[model samples]
Target: MGSGDLNLLKSWNPKLVKNREKVWIKEQELLKENEILKQKQLEITKERELDSLVDPHHKHKNSKKNGLEWMYSDPTHNEDYLLGKKSLDSSVISKNNLKNDSKVDSKIDSEQTKKFDYSNDDPMSKFKIAKKRHIIQTKEKISKPTSPL
Candidate 1:
């Protein structure tokens, strides 16, 4: 080959080499990222497996209820029941106080009445309106003028 061809080859060769090196570096990075992702996926799967194994709900069907009770119940289980009763009593006292507070009671009554009114409204009426509007919009779109000539 002539010097011109040699020069051209030399110029092109470094670029090709650089391109190949870039591709190789990118592949390595991708491989590293893929490995990290795979490890994360493995960790997630291991966590799920461990969670399933440790979960009281996943115990043998016959033992599940007892396992759940044991897992969730306080260390001194009776204490929890007593505390629950105390909380119930406290709530009752608070409810009585609210009833005695005329302003609070009125507000609560108004809120409850509004909720009752909303509940009394037929839920299906909203669905029917939505369906009717959808049909009307669809028909309008379908019947829209195509073009002006």
Candidate 2:
């Protein structure tokens, strides 16, 4: 209660004023608690709405076209990606780092292109088959001890 409220209470009997203050305080507390419960209900409803939208097992005839369905199958969102989470931080970075990354990416791409052979003699031959090495197991000679009767 503000000073104005207290000043208003002064016109009433002292005992009645005290009782009114207590009642006001209790009402204020209840109001705050009611607001908190309302906020919680809103949050629970939002979570349920999001769960309904983002179902992992949901698929369509034409490869799950658009929105939450497409986002569900995305490789980056495979685990622990919550849709309702806060936006990304606005941390500034040096332009030099980004430039270096682009240069490195271009170099890697060029190297990969050079390494890739387009010739396909056989469909199966295009895939490199790894030779299986034979592992020999050597048996250790165990000498039998003479049994004493």
Candidate 3:
């Protein structure tokens, strides 16, 4: 072989060059996939932020929690309930329907209260009780008259 051909043969490493190409291809594919995922995440966050701007209360309204959470969290709903008015019942509703809705709400409330069975094994039960107790103690300390030292 000529000197030029021998130099080319000596410099060529096919296995290493092929491995490098494979690694580069894999890196490019991973980078492209990562960029696509970032774009989708940004789009989802933008949509959620826009919805929040349009209706700040949509989260509470659209949440999939059990019916219990709305009572303490929704001030408007609580006020409506205190006023003996169902959310769907307008001011122009007949007195009979109003009474019927109130009765239904009362029955549901009673049943829920009666069926609230917090077990000792419940992981959050102790925490909830402790939180309430701490709140009560703080309120009591705040309300109590301090002795003149």
Residue by residue across 36-133, what tens digits does model 1's lDDT show? Answer: 99999999899768867887465443433334665443243234447765444676667656655765567567757755646425779878888999
lDDT (tens digit, per residue) of candidate 2 on 36-94: 99999999899767755885433332243346655433244212324655444323234
Clashes of each: 0, 0, 0
Residue runs of model 2 more than 4 Å from their true location after superposition:
1-15, 56-149
Sorting all predicted structures by lDDT, with the top scorer first, yields: 3, 1, 2
Query: Residue-wise lDDT of candidate 3 within 12-117, one digit each (tens)?
Result: 5544676669888999999999999999999989988997898787786546546686564423434555686755455534664666688778877975886577
Distance from true location, Cα of 20 in model 3, Å: 0.6
| Residue-level lDDT for 101 in candidate 3 | 80
lDDT, candidates in the order shown:
0.68, 0.57, 0.73
- TM-score each candidate: 0.34, 0.30, 0.34
Each prediction's RMSD over C-alphas, in Å, is: 19.1, 20.5, 14.9
Residue pairs that clash (backbone atoms under 3 angstroms), model 1: none
Task: Give the Cα error of residue 7 in candidate 2, in Å.
Answer: 22
By TM-score: ranked, best first: 1, 3, 2
Lowest lDDT 10-residue stretch of candidate 2:
130-139
* Better model by lDDT: candidate 2 vs candidate 3: 3
